[model samples]
Target: MAAPLDLDQLQTFIAIADTGSFTRAAEEVHRTQSAVSMQMRRLEERIGKQLFEKDGRVNRLSEDGERLLAYARRMLRLNRETIAAFDDRRLEGHVRIGTPDDYADRFLPEIMARFARSNPRVELSVICEPTVNLVEQIRRGTLDLALVTHDDEKGQSEVVRHEPLLWVASSNHAVHEEEVLPLAVGRPTCVWRRAAIDMLDQMERDYRVLFTSWSATVIIASVISGLAVSVLPECALRPGMRVLGESDGFGTLPDCRIGLMRGHTGQPAIVEALARHVSESLDNITLPASEEAGMFDFAAMMAMRPRRHRPNMMPGW
Candidate 1:
């Protein structure tokens, strides 16, 4: 007869795989590093194979670990769904969500505020991280939901919204003629960076990444100050930025797909509600008209308004 697997050990193994550090995983699971190590050892002994290679500074999954990740994810998701099914009340517990920092700063506040109005009793915890990190956290049960860029190679999740990607630069910056295209890009694994680079490569354009940061504000600031250019969602552009003219050979970049993803669980009400709110909010967003003919004049009213700090102002406010 086959031996029964230890659920606790499996959870530990999954945590280690997701976090890539035993110490971090131990802290997340509320166990000591030694305890996490012992659980993994016991799991490996039962399975008769080493799940991870501990040679490097960071713990890397072995062939066995990679093979078991799918099963572990399925089992954990099922466990959570089963528990939720029994406690099918008004979702009074906490719902932890993760999003890219840009999305959190730009669009998430309004959606969350609306959600709060509807579910006042439910607690919401939002974490802002890179898309890859957020996806890993969701898979590891650390987050209840996440909105990230959908990669065709990685497959689609439950799509919430999809918007066109637009190239933007400062109004004062010259297009196509600049020696090295100053680009403000997010960190590695950013979809916008990949899309921008791929488009530039295909067009045979010479460019240099002058600035790279994970903050959308940094990207906007650099572009507004005429220091760099960036590509972002059409809805994210603000005043003082300009979309390059197509006559300058700046057009033809492809669109990026952004979506909401959640683990398979029976709590469809919350997911559906959140999805509806996001879709509606994004659809209603209107970008300012372009100043130049055929090109979006994103800086049309740059002088009309002063940047004021309004505490408690939500996104889209």
Candidate 2:
């Protein structure tokens, strides 16, 4: 008889692949790092294939791991649906969902698509804006729900994912090697922009803002063309960019908290339902740690991108 796949191990595998580190995976699953490591070993043995490979200090998904990721996501989603079919309550209402363009590009489509399938009556209207503006909109009840990137540890926002800020530049461009670092920054209110500048100031490093915009694509384009470097969450690392670490002489940056904020107190059920769905969907997101490698499907991300030009800044969001 063939060895059966353990759902727990499969979950662990997805977490590791998603987070790009066993340590982060352990945090995700609420297990010790050693325990996560053990689970991976057992899972690989059962599958009879290596699932991850070492890339510098991080463990990247192997080709087999990448292939398994697709299956794992579908299986887990189906598994949740199968189990919820018996007792799942129908969720219905208008949910005004808002997020920065970058996150909307990376994770929103999948989340919204799945939510729509599960709750056909739930009307979802999305807004893409800067985090600072989005938070204000949420507070004023202009938006029912928002996902934002924040550095506040004391805030009441329900955190979805937490990761450190990473210094990123195009792999083809050696922007970081310049004496006076050029920066492709967001608007003045951007948390990532603030964090990056503060770190540079503390380090007494010289930097010049080459470009500032609310559009993430513009910033990425600047970096890709060797115009400047930018700080972003680990999840934003794409195929063309590289992550700069301490060894690269960049000062450490503060961690970012991506969280959900509720603006309207009314319709608790719908808000909670969407909030729960967002949490579950985000939990499965796997961002590449650096440019030379990533387990995520960039093609899927490209496909999910909306046709029209949308404001696309907000690093942590």
Q: Go through the candidates in order and give the clash count of each.
A: 3, 2
User: Compared to the true structure, candidate 2 yields what TM-score?
Assistant: 0.67
Worst 10 residues of 1 by lDDT: 308-317
Model 1, range 151-172, lDDT digits (tens) per residue?
7678746554556677788776
Tell me how far the alpha carbon of residue 136 in candidate 2 is from the true structure, in angstroms, after superposition. 1.1
* RMSD in order of candidates: 17.2, 9.9
Which candidate number would show the highest TM-score if scored against the true structure?
2
lDDT of each residue in 1-317, candidate 2, tens digit only? 98668888889887766565677678899999888888889888988898877665555677898788778867877776665555557666788988987688888977897787667777999999988788889879888889888647447477777666678877786889899999999988788999999999998889999899988888878877778999876556566776676667887676777889998768888888788788767766664435423533334333232221111111110
Error of 1 at 118 (Å): 1.2
Query: Which sections of candidate 2 miss by over 4 Å?
Result: 1-80, 83-89, 153-156, 288-317
Candidate 1 positional error at 268, Å: 5.6
